[model samples]
Target: MTAVSLVDVASHLPPERVGREYFERYSRPDDPLLRNPMFRAPEYRRYAAREDTGADLVERAAAVLFERHGSDLAGEIDLLVTHNALPDVPFLGSGAEIARRLGCRPAQIVDLHNGHCAVFPYMLGLARSLMRDTGARTALLCTAQTAGRIFTQPGVRRSAHAAVPGDGAAVGLLRASGESPILATEVRHYPDHAPDVALKLDDGRLYWEPGTSEFDVAFDNSKAYNIIERGSEIVPEVVTRVCERIGATPKDIDLLVTNQPNRLLLRNWGAALGIEAPRHFDTFDSYGNLFGAGVPVNLDHALRAGRPAGGGLVVMAGFAGAGELAAAAAVRLPGPDRPATPTTGGPR
Candidate 1:
């Protein structure tokens, strides 16, 4: 079978509504009562105001993707894939809505709601399969996250989820190709940690409960710890596997697009892996953690900032709701001669 490669990728954030200044002012000041500092960072607009919901982020991101590709809703898009945890509204799934807005037919849509690490790899696998079965020439893969809706709470002092979660969304276009720049992909799952990260139903509402005390006592105690504890191990392992399969290493990669859970986590993970942190592109400093959207959004930033030079590789990894871990690598295709412009505009 021919290896699959991502042909085009792009990302989007609501707008530059939140920034460092906002964080410094709002986040708790030395709240020693909780595991981590109380969400001191200024609350993101999506979380703070609730003006634009997760669905809104997805729509805006889809608009950005379409614009970047220089394609219209009427274009020849064969498949649409979206990775997300919190759908726009509780009742209707965001994937269907996104496809509708893009004018995609029902049969052409696929929704993967597997949380963090599983998203990228799952999407790659689905895209690969679609290419083989249907010979889909154009597939729109989008990951949209709205951390604000998930983490923030009323009168809750500090939350592990709050410390890192951010809001954002990203989209990518993939097509079957036999090319060097767009390389192969591999995926794996560690079922042992399945109970570590997850969302639980409480009074009919979904809440991110990173493994509770009872869960810790029952399962591997340490597994319930914050994502950082195992993140270092999981990320490098996946990266090594993907790189080894492709005959490349961290040094050869021009960009490392991982989940932007936290600045410190990214720094520590990069150092531990001996991979110079690829130009860290982040919306988390302002947006918070957009659960599934991290990788794709960052990839879009790297592309817009100026495509990395020859043989540039992008390593994307994430861990979300279900103690899930996902990682994939894509080489940058020769960029378009003309940079694409943003057709949709909003708060930024």
Candidate 2:
């Protein structure tokens, strides 16, 4: 059985100036904030709502991944997998739109619509299954989140929603290879608390009520709060299982990528595991939260930008709405056959 390694990764962020200035200009000194010191400054897009559509972001990023690898988009890929919660339109999944833009045929596309945690694991599992069953050679995996639409709702607390989320997309090429096969993957689901962190359809629009309230009556459940508390435990447990299956300790991990919710959650989880802080490749503070795209986006950023490169174990963990957690580990393959090159593509 051949192992799977991310052959190439690419990401796109909406223009980074508009939102940054808006926050700086309006944010108060006393507002509750979770600062991510790893970033010298926040990364964000200005007027992302008006500037770019969600499908546009995904297509642009995928174009870069193909160009960087010097692979022919039409010939190289046997399958395409997309993960997103808030897709561009109600009826059409983002995967189909991406495939259409890339000129890929209907037979080549599959859509996985789950929250943040569901995307990567679903893609990984699909790749593994395809390799075992159909002997497919290459697959394109993409994840994107356009939280701008969610946070821009009238009356929703923009400070809380906008502070953490940023719009972005990540794309990766996964191929069947003998060298770096995916070792182990584990996913934990906590359904009893499903209502805690949920996106609901109110009237005709989508609404996100992060936390529950006790006070009066309607829609006052603290689901978001419960998700955080339970997530603390879920993340550690999932990581432990992945480490044990792979016969590696948390200390042995060279890089750990967790869902970019906030700086505080990352720190708390790092402390809980007694692992020194791994190089945090975060886009959340600047981009806000990219929902399902979090892990792939971070991995793409770390790989493309310069980082200490040698063979070491890397962990990718995802935690999304409703206390769902997915964890997987891969040994960073020795640097590519040739030094990596910058991707040439249009603005995403």
Candidate 3:
């Protein structure tokens, strides 16, 4: 029996509105990427409001979930796991602070720093395993992407890739119940690509060391090509493996959601798996690249819009940080037209 299922998802996007004009001011029409069909200027209008200027994005998102579900849901969480690509506090994740602010005293707390964009499934896998092993009923998983804080800098903003990232947070509520049950999941890590995604600075100072040189993505042409190919391949690979685990195929999934890096990867993954555009969910045109929060945010978007209908099979799949980690899962979505209140579940 499945131990945990994603009962619901809620997202918090900042109030600020930025547009393609924001990036166009720095980049020119002659930019090679502008002409690439695969490339699209990030038109995400929201910013998480420079690091720490307001309530944490994760907190805001979770508050929405609790408000919609009930305050009691906050008290029921047994485990809380958080993944933020850019942590406001150095040497400390925002998990403890978030839990504190939300009035949740979880039995366990995890502040994961890696797993990147694909960490959504990784967290889901971790939640189910822990819930089963510890005899717990509920878990809260939170992911935030604040890449805009760094990308908006004068030094880095000139590059086109700088505009690819946006800011927001999405938190999912998982319970040990059949409501929105998770069917099967697969997670993989490749050490060869672990070092491929990195930060570059011309001054040769380590990221931790004090330096005046601004940082940017270190990807070169060879690394970029290899990463793109691996990304185009690995995501579908995991999705297929997951579907096959449950005696189905990607064709059986009613809706597909993945990290919204850009149009290139999105189109490639669907084409590779034969999933059509209508059945696939995308937020790139409005939300840009949301990093780890991308998938959950999209899931929340779909649910709020009353999409994929009820009793549908949905698949969430993507790779994280270059191509080092990938994960996918098959889920039986909740019924009756939209996300519903969760039923507390535990050991059978």
Tens-place lDDT per residue, model 2, 98-122, is 8878776634677777546546755
Ranking by TM-score: 3, 2, 1
For model 2, state the Cα shift of residue 337 in Å.
10
Best by TM-score: 3
Ranking by lDDT: 3, 2, 1
RMSD of 3: 3.1
Residue ranges of candidate 1 with Cα displaced over 4 Å: 1-4, 19-51, 70-73, 157-163, 178-182, 198-226, 278-283, 335-348
Task: Please provide, for model 1 over 75-112, each residue's C-alpha lDDT reduced to its tens digit, 9 standing for 90 to 100.
Answer: 66678887665566665656777776777763478777
Candidate 3: give the clashing pairs.
Answer: none
lDDT for position 127 in model 3: 83
Model 1 lowest lDDT segment of ten? 212-221
Model 2 lDDT at residue 6: 56
Query: lDDT of candidate 3 vs native?
Result: 0.81
